[model samples]
Target: MRPAAPEDEPALDAFFGHVDAEDLRFRFLSAVRKVDHDQLKAMVTIDHDRTEHFLAFDPASGQIIATAMLAADQSFRRAEVAIAVHRDFKRMGISWTLLDHVAEFARWKGILTLESIESRDNHDAIDLERERGWIASACPGDPTSTILRMTL
Candidate 1:
């Protein structure tokens, strides 16, 4: 896996097609039918100091199989993280590895806490995060979603 760049825009667009629609909604926290050009642009063209987007590539095929993004607040004390794996790559421990990698990366960047807002129905992700010591709480005014937080 490597930090995403502007050149990765096209690849990310294609990668999303391989992700399950439900997973897409989980990643974006919305019912997104398709990713647009502007959304892809915002992802790849980020300031390295405050935001980092990572693309995980399959070693054999060299195809993008997953992505993890971390965006820090102005104080850099906390950051929101999001990740997604292609449907074919699910249940392969990709999400676990990516979460670890993102956490370590956030620590290196001086972020004190990491947060992920996941849909309440995403049991696997919530379970994995809980096992990793993340605490879950209700999303303010949004009963359909839950906020998971961890301190690095």
Candidate 2:
């Protein structure tokens, strides 16, 4: 796994397609946006001027299977981490790998806390955050979404 690149845009879109539609909606907060190739790239593509994006690939097959983003807010000393695993690799630990990578990056980057904006319906994601000791609370700016935070 490594930082995402411009050339991996297509793979990123394909992998997003591999995840269940409901999972995508849960992560993104809307089922209406199809997340076209351009949008997917913008979502996970690296931009040092802005956010950091990570991609995981199969060692043998060289296939990108999971992706995550850690976007830091300069004024807050906090970062938002988002991750997705291809449905084909759902039970294979890819999501955990992505989370671990993001967590490490957050620590290395001097981020005091990491937050995950999850929908109330996304039990799996909420459970994962709970398992990792993230505190769940109502989103400060948006009441509809639940925010999970963890100290680095």
- My TM-score estimates for the predictions, one after another, are 0.98, 0.90
Model 1 C-alpha lDDT per residue in residues 1-152, reported as the tens digit of each score: 99999999999999999988999888898999899999999999999999999999999988899999999999999999999999999999998999999999999999999999999999999999999999999999999999999999
Model 2, position 30, has a per-residue lDDT of 84
| RMSD (Å) per prediction | 0.7, 1.9
Name the candidate that leads on lDDT. Answer: 1
Candidate 1 weakest lDDT stretch, 10 residues: 20-29
Model 2 lDDT tens row, 53-96 = 88888887888887788889965489998887877788787777
Candidate 1, position 20, lDDT: 89
What TM-score number comes out for model 1?
0.98
